[model samples]
Target chain A: MRHSGYQIWLLTLSLAAATLGAIVYATGMGHIAVPASEIIRVIAARVTSNPALLAGIDPVFPFVVFDVRLPRILTSTLVGGGLAMSGVIYQGILLNPLADPYTLGVSSGAAFGAALALLANLTMMGHFSVPLFAFGGAALTLLVVLYLSSFNGQISANTLILSGVIVGAILAAGISFLKYLADEQVAVIIFWLMGSFASRTWLDVTVVAMAVVFGLGLSFFYARDLNILSLGSRSADTLGVESGRVRWILLLGASLVTAVCVSVSGIIGFIGLIVPHLMRFLVGPDNRKLLPVSILAGALLLLVADTVTRAVLPVEVPIGVLTALIGGPFFCVIFRKRQRRVA
Target chain B: MSATSGFGLSGVSFDYGTTPALVDLDLCLPPGKFYGIVGPNGCGKTTFLDMLTGSKSPDRGSVTFMDRPVAEYRRRDLARLVALVPQDFGIDFAYTVQEVVLMGRHPYIGRFASPGAEDWRQVDAAMAAIGISHFKDRFVNELSGGEKQRVVVARALAQQTQFLLFDEATSSLDVQYTMQIFNVARNLVRGEGRTVIAVIHNLNLAAAYCDEIIFMQAGKVVACGPSDSVLESSMIKKVFGVESRVEVDDFSKTKQISFRYWS
Candidate 1:
């Protein structure tokens, strides 16, 4: 059946809003015994009932709900959206369905840079120095990969994937070297690698929000280019798309956002690789529609995953463990479905 | 037939690594003409077409359109005049026919502006002109090979370019679909004054449809001019190493070449 463009946008907006609300509510219910009413009460008191009611309430309840859970939930929404949008751009630009932020080696480079910053005392100078270093590292690594792949004149998908694999290995080696230098600092590196959202504050929220907003804004700006690139590079160029320019811009943009997210929350995996693919299955691959919807879906999935990681057991499970546990089977199911379709 | 020349290549040559692809290639295409290029594998037929559409730059000499070097033109400005139809059409998305056609209007769109009503009307007209309007809402990826070829041609037409290059565009199509595609190309040239340069492997089909033929051998133009001059039995044997019989059927008044042996 034919669907008007307006109808699709409207439907997407509703879905995103509904998912946003659900993430907020569910994350509020995690890591504590707060009922839904109490969660709402804590939020309402902070917003509407002013400082008087806030003063009378148990400081711990308000602190857990408003201070702790709220920032963590907001950070997850922004990071998830950023990662998914990055996946969409990478897949479209590279013209490969398997392309994602990590596949391009952005995450490994960021991990190396974060490790370097921690071991080198770079963050001792400024609060946001580590995240800044990570962002710069990701952008630089992507630029190098893009340059190397385009060396023979045309940037083929295979070339990008091959370069990404090579560069990722190199960055992983660098991270290991850093890990070995400071034996006691191994705990910090391991925690970062396993991925967590354990200690988020409003300051972390602000930095992540800034990066995600910039990333999504750039995604929308190049949404049309992404759609054209999906038609294949030759067709894209024939249709007046400067393929190289679009590719460089998108890779750097996505890498920057992903680096910031990883730097702040550690190396949360699977959301970038899975959320965009799931959104593509549901809504097809028009970047105009796929991008915004994926953003919402990613946030929703990550938030739910984050809540489960916290609430499923007395001890908090690392976010990476939960995502890996869910992502492997989920990817297998998608692969089997794809195989059936191809057959 | 028309006053304007769609493309002109002069003193052009190219090489891939150490092997020469095109050596001092020269060709001129007038507007509203159907030019078919035929050659064996690795004969540089596709390379010639790519140079004309600005996909690959010539190593020496120049390609010009309307007296301007092709490279000097802005990307969108070049697209406004010429469109290329590559042989392979693989898309990961499930965009409907209308949506794919609308993509051809990318050059006309402004930043953040959606396609206006007239733009969609043009998309509909292009689809209707190609007789695929019935599949407007059907997913493009689900179409048969022939249908996909037609849809892609329709997209090129929607670009509103004056010249189109078809790089072995019909290799994957069936017999009936191949002729249908040729008929569409014929209409675009005859009715709309659009110039078309197509790389075709089927000599008989080219004989029946093309106004001019250029035959390449090992990256050089061995023969070019009228279709009758280029499709001679001797040239076919020399370029393709196939013993072939050439005959002109009286009913169709077309030269047909049929290959019989490798020698």
Candidate 2:
């Protein structure tokens, strides 16, 4: 069984690699028509071996492949991977497979924060302030949820969910207040609300990259605790897990990862909820393998969605819309199958 | 505290906030004996198990395992010695039985070190021992209640600890499966010399399976001794408020409680 698992994982990796490469090459082909050869040349040049060839290549091809397409692709990859990983961690921690960034209200809180900052012209100083305040909002909302959920020290699952819903409602109300106060830029505010990866740069990608890497690192360390937690908190404690401490750390880490991803790319939904479920079906529920696999699958899925949105229509479709379109049906299929199994 | 104190509870007590769950409880179990705790619901059976397993710290005193205060042992070290098989588990993810069993090896795994061939061998052996080798690759969440309970026991076995605690591991199981599990536990104690402690509800089941029985009522131990001695008709009536006939099984020399009250 174990050997079969390794073989299956290797197979998954190969499939993911192929899918990722195809999406990149195909997506790079459209609009700009950067040839496959040029794409490869630029990639190879960027990596090593032949800088002179890369330098000799047309600056337009290099610019299109490296600067424009790569950042966008990388952004989708980071955000998708981060969201999926966060989803896995949250599900394990909560013992609820339905949990995701949105369930915890981190997305709504960050969106409200980003909207507040953007609409109020707080970003007038710089674009970085938007993400900074968005992260702050996410963290603050998490603190509020944690505080509200704790009943004399123990955090019940019901209380946690209820707290998140309440906090999310409050944040949404705040966003509406901002919307009402705004005289113009309602379009930009609405765009932010709907979600987008429209304007990504290397810096945005770097910020998301750091958050994902850091969150994934924290998750790996807590993965064992998470497995114990899945047994239920009392049992987890019997297994010598510091249940409360581990929970707080994981919840905070997952929320932080979600906030950073949303701040950079705007609330990309469904990837978090769907990617982990798909990965769990493929790999067993062990977080050790589930997390990394979900990250890869999520990146691939979101990249495909974004690529399709860009290619399917002349007008740019918000990446969020495309994800929900694909994710919603996929989610229904899973839910239906689960209902049948339960029945 | 001696080097061989397997488990010791000194004046331990617990409360569900204001309501007391356990009061002035004291227990000492040497490392290598099969022991049983028998009680009804709301009698603190689960709470006692929680205290013994470090899930709930005592409100007053402390529990010591292996000569070290349980609180002093790091979570990892505590797991190496004591393994718990909880009554029920909720699994959201569909981990295969083998994978679930392999997680018992978590404490032993070093950083960046994946489970090697030997670890898989141990897991396979555990699965085979529990008669669930056929279900090694099957999703755990998909298993029936009895099968899932066995898988949990197999996980505890894979932990390879000297001390194993079962919190009513077989309550939901059918008669044959329950007997099969207890037989396994008996073998672990008699054949392998491992210490086993179980919180069992059915007095007849405990009488048949346990070598020694501790009867609890109202957060305290009412009677404790060899199964026959602790499982008397008087003690059963006193603790459970139910009249019962106690008969000695000739083959096993165990006292079996037969309830007379229908209503």
Candidate 3:
């Protein structure tokens, strides 16, 4: 349903408030029974630098909230938002709502890069090598997919999807070959591919944060062009958008967002696709509004998903596995719906 | 308006690989006129529109707007000068009609800026001019073909350009909608002094609305003049390979045609 401005603003405000609540609740989770009240008190004390609020709090509680949980939860939220933001760009540029980083093969490219780094034990950039390589792989894949799909200057949706499928298939084979070469270290590769946020450090948060921020800056900068682009390339160009240049910039920026998120958290899938779908229903198709709401909604969805795996669930499931579990069925529903529309 | 006030094409040619779509075509389109490009299928009518609208540049010559090469104009600047109503108006995403029309303001608004009050005023005026203000809040994807076509026209109207190109914009419509669209284009030209160009398949509609007509055959213009003169029986037989009779409808004071397959 199309919402009026009042309704949209109300929904955005509520989502923002809900995200804050989720963060507090999520931080109090895992083995420790620290209530949300304690989470708030500890955070307040730390921020104000006053001993009065922390007078009676357990010393371990501050470390738990500030050190252990904050980084991981913050990282998950930012990564989730970043992925969803990228999804909006992909869907807008490709003019197909089903298009996402995963569907476009960007995530697989990042996965392949990380796997290659793992196999080679390439520590050239030390701990930074994996993400650097992942970024390289994703950037390279984007160029190849664009080149393969483009004819003259126009990139058709069908050609792009087909090229992505072919490139992704070949990359999947390359990843498997790397796994075989990994031999003893294949287990590590397998685990990373599954995706997780456990034991995430500030460095992980910092890197993903920087990439996502830069990405968001680009998204906001080109949000108007993206809105025009949804009308298709020829129309968009006539409507005053440099469709080719905008598509390349936005696609590369979004792919870089995906690359960083995947490098940090592995191939977490559906948050990108599902969050935008949900937000579109709430906010309609204008990217300027859809984008900000999608970012918040995506962060909340991923944070809740991670929380369930981290604390509420009896068995720890990989974040990637859980998103795919939910996202796969969701994808089928969307696919079936689109098929019905066509039929 | 000076010599540069309208569109000019000289030595224009385009090809799909070895097959030429437009060949060595030179034409002048004046301001404040309603012009129609007419030809049979694959006769470079659409290709000519594509070249004029800058969707495709001429391979061998220059297309100028106001005496300046269209290629030299920035995309946004060109968009401000000319707006196109494409043949297909179907969009996959659901944006409200108001939102779709508001996109015309893109050329005037900065990348970081939102549509301010003046922009909305133009949008409302355009929608009002097209008589679609009742469905302003409705999703564009849900509109009927005629209504959507009107919405697309409203978008171009909202662009507030000096020129409008209709690339078979009414080809999918019924006879009623086609007449309605032409009436709107004619009104724009007569009332607002806009340069309106349409690539039309229906000779009757073109004859009824267009002040001037260009007839193309085999990637070249065979005849061009006032519609009554340009769309005669001889031109019809030679260009479209059809036998036709042209008449000036007394009541409407416009050219009309009756056609049969060539014997």
Candidate 4:
């Protein structure tokens, strides 16, 4: 069904407001529980450049809100948004409902890069080295997959998916080998692989935020063309959509978003897969409407997951483990329902 | 047909890897008439339509629409002048029928702009013309095959191009809708002076609606002319390897062919 522009705008606005509310609420729930008012006050002060707003709060409150909670919260939110946006693009470009950001093997590539960095103990770039390497690995993997899939300047969905699976398997094996090489440090490597937002800093947040914003803008700009692309390449060509050019641009753009997100947060799965499907259920399949709503929903989902793991759980489970535990069952439900409907 | 005024192909050839789809050939199709291409499977009928729409460029020679090389026109410009209804449209997404039809305006709509009121009006008119206005709000995937084919036809109509190519577009529709759609195409050709080229599977239907007929066999045009001249029994036997009785239908005043197996 077609959603009116007003309805989509209203839905997007509500989602944006809810994400902000969740961020503020989540920021206040940690060990040293600051009130929501103080969280808002600290954020307000930071935004307004006014020290006067910090008068009555405990000195530790500002430090915890800014240095401890907010960075991790924002990073998880942006990463979630980025992954979800990527999922929408990947699914649309591939024209497969089952496709996700990881369908391109971007996460496996990023994981392989991070594992290599950890095994080698490279610290030349300090906290940025691993993420930088991971991004590089993802970029290279995307190039390889694109190269393998393209035949006479045309890339079919089946070939692209096949190439991704083959490349991803190779990378998965390479990561396993890196784990074997880590020996005593395998626990650290494993922990990173499990994924977390435990110690994310402002730098991580900024990187993800930039990538998500740019990616969202580009995706939205091409959302109409993406919708036409679902009609298949020949129809899209007849409708004047440069199917080859637009498909690859969207593939590269979405892979870039996935790369940055996975590099920052390790292998966070299912958000990219689930968020688009969930939002499509709500907003219909028009990518123009789906892109913004999916991004916000993704950000909200990841932030809530991070908050639950960080505060509500008795012990801190890795965020990735928590998401997979929840999302795997959730995905099965969606898949089963779709199968029943088709039957 | 005047070569300078209509779609003209000279020494055109295209191949699928090592296999030839369209051999080196020359053909000219004039505007403002319905032309039907009939051939057995894998006879390059669909490939010919692809060439006219510029979806596939010929490996040799030139294809021109209105005396301009089809390759020289921008993709959008070509789309503005020509539209196609493919045989198989495999869309599994849940876009409403109106939304699908509205996508025909993509070539005219700006990259960042939304579909204007004019675009919606064209969509509504096209849907109405194709008798699918009632199901405008229905999800395309939920519709029956015939309904979905109507929606696709409506989309091409909404494109409002002078040249329309149908690649076995009515294969899924029932006889009633198929005849209705052909009547609509005939009206587009007669009243609006548009050009239509349909790769038809049914010989009688093509003979009834098409102003001209082109028969292809083994990647070559075996016959091309009016239905009375080109659509004879021998040509049908030669192309399809079947014996047929060609008779003039008293009701429709058109040639009708009935096929028979070799005894």
Q: Write the per-residue lDDT of candidate 4 for residues B238-260, one digit (tens) a residue.
A: 89989999999898788998888
Q: What TM-score, computed on C-alpha atoms, does each candidate reach?
A: 0.90, 0.89, 0.93, 0.93
Off by over 4 Å in 2: A1-3, A19-30, A40-67, A119-129, A139-170, A339-343, B1-4
Clash pairs of candidate 2? none
Residues A1-343, candidate 4: write the lDDT tens digits. Answer: 3457788899999999999999999999978999999998998999999989999999999899999999999999999999899889888877767567576778888788877876788899987677777777887888898789888656665577689889989998898888898898988777878889988889989888888888988898889999999998899989998887898788778877787788778888889889998888788998988998999999999999999999998999998898878777876786677667667
Candidate 2 chain B: worst-modelled 10 consecutive residues by lDDT: B1-10
Q: How accurate is candidate 3 locally (lDDT)?
A: 0.87
TM-score of chain A of 3: 0.94
Task: Provide the clash count, candidate 4.
Answer: 0
Residue B212, model 1: lDDT of: 92
B19-118: candidate 3 lDDT, tens digit per residue:
9999999999989999988888999887888787788889998998888898888999999989999887768788999999999888999888778999
Over 4 Å off in model 1, which ranges? A1-7, A23-27, A30-55, A60-67, A124-128, A136-170, A339-343, B1-5
Clashes of each: 0, 0, 1, 0
State in Å the error of residue A241, model 1: 1.6
User: What's the C-alpha lDDT at position A85 in model 3?
Assistant: 98
Candidate number with the higher lDDT (2 or 3): 3
Better by lDDT, candidate 3 or 1: 3
In model 3, pairs of residues that clash are B4-B66
* Ranking of candidates on DockQ, top first: 4, 3, 1, 2
